[model samples]
Target: MPKPFKIPQSVLVVIYTPAWDVLLIRRTEADPSAPAFWQSVTGSKDTLDEPWEQTAAREVLEETGLDCTPGSALAPHLHDWGLENIYNIYPRWRHRYARGVTHNLERVFGVQVPDGSVVTLNPREHTDYQWLPYDAAADACFSPSNAEAILQLPHYAKQRLGTAA
Candidate 1:
C-alpha cells in the first residue's frame, strides 16, 4: 500500500475572459527552496484514464477557486483546441512520477469566463496571479509548451465568439 506516485498525464487549461485576458499563475515552487515559475492552470490526472476535460476543470478550480460550471449563467466556455503535447519531464521534478516515467502527455483546453469574474487563489499552490493580454501572457510563461499554448488563444477566442478578442 505504499504506492502514491503521480500519474504522468496532465491538463494545461488556459482560462481567459471573453476579452482575451488570460489568467496565469506563478507556481509557488517544485520545492520550497526552488524558484517559482509562471504557468497556466495545470495539474496531473488522478489516474491515467481520467477524462482530460474533467482534469482541466478540477485543476482550474483547485488552483484558482474559480468554478467552471457547465451551462450556468457564469458558465465556463470550455473548448478543446485539438492540441496535445508530449514532452520529457524535467529531471528536478521526476520524483513525483513513478520510477522511469520520463515524459508527460499534456492536453490543452480553454475556459472562457465572463468579464468581472472573481479570482480566488490557493496560496500554497501559487504565489501570484495575473490577468494579462494574450501576447503578454504567452511571454510570461516559463515553459515553452505553456507559451506556445497561450499564443493560440487569440485565434481560439475569435473562433469561439466570432468577434474580435
Candidate 2:
C-alpha cells in the first residue's frame, strides 16, 4: 500500500515562553545539504479535514515530546495567530502531495511555555534544540515563513498577556 498523500493545509507553530525565550529545533541532515538549519514545530494535517489546532498539538508532541492538549499539566499555552500563508510547495517537496498539487496553505500558531522548560526532542525528527531569544530564533530559522512567524512572537505574546506592544 502507498503512503497517504499529504494534506496541503499545514501549521507552523512558534514555541516560546513568557520570558521571550523561543524554542528552535534543528532538522536532521537529509532534505538539504546545508548546515543543520533551525525551525519551530511544523507539520501538515493528518487528513484533509483535520483542525489546524489539532495539527499544531500533534506536531508539537511528535517533534518535541511536549504536551499542548487543551488542559495538560504543563498547560503549554497555544494561540492561533489567525494568519495563513499560501505558497507554492518547493519542487523537491511537491511529491509528498497529490499530483498537480503545487501549492500549500500554512496556518500560523504560537505556543507559550515556561522558562527553561525541559525539551525532549524526537531524535528521528530533530537532532538538536535550543532556547533562544525572539530575535535570535527568528534569525536562526532557515525557512522564511518560520522566521517570520518567530518575528511576530513578541506581538502575540504581548497581546496574550494583556499588555500593549
Candidate 3:
C-alpha cells in the first residue's frame, strides 16, 4: 500500500540556547550531489487533527533528540511564537502532498534549551547539526520563511526572558 500524502500543514521549531545560539540541522539529500542547506526542526503532523504543539514536540525529539514533553528538561521553555507563514511549496517537494496542493501552512515555535545541550541528528533525516548565532543562522537557512523566522528570534527571546518592553 502507498503511504498517505502529507498534510499541507506543518510546524517549524527553532531550538536555541540561553546565549541566543540557534540550532540548525542540515537535511540529508537523496542526491549526494545536491547542495545541502540548514534548517530548524520542521515536520508535518502525523494526522490532520494533531495539535500543533504536539507536532512541534514530536518533531523536536525526532529531529534533534531533544525531549520537550511536559516535565522534561526543555518543557518549561517551549514556546509557541503565535506566528504563521503561508508559502508555496518548492516544486521538488510538492509531490509529498496531494496533487494540486501547492502551498503549505507553517506554524512557528521556539524552544530554549540550556547552553551546551547535546544535539543528536537522526541520520535518516539530517546529516549534521550546528548551533550558530541567530544572525548567522538566519543567513544559513535555505528557506526564506525559515530565515525570516530566525530573524525574529531576538524578539521572542526577549519576551521569553521577560525583558520585552
Q: Which candidate number has the best lDDT?
A: 3
Taking all chains together, the TM-score of candidate 2 against the true structure is 0.93
lDDT tens string, model 2, 1-165? 999899899999998887888999998744676766899998999987788888999899889988987688544488899989988898988888999999889999998887777889888878889998999889888888888888888888898889987
The number of clashing residue pairs in model 2 is 0
For lDDT, candidate 1 versus 3, the one ahead is: 3
> What order do candidates take by lDDT, descending?
3, 2, 1
Q: How big is the RMSD of model 3?
A: 1.3
For each candidate, the alpha-carbon lDDT, in order, equals 0.85, 0.87, 0.91
Per-prediction CA RMSD (Å):
2.4, 1.6, 1.3
lDDT of 1 by residue, 1-165 (tens): 776988988989998887888998988775556555778999999977788878887788889888775554434477777899999999988998888999999999998887777888898889888899989999888889999999999888788778765
Superposition error at 107 for model 3 (Å):
0.3
Q: How close is candidate 3 to the true structure, as a TM-score?
A: 0.95
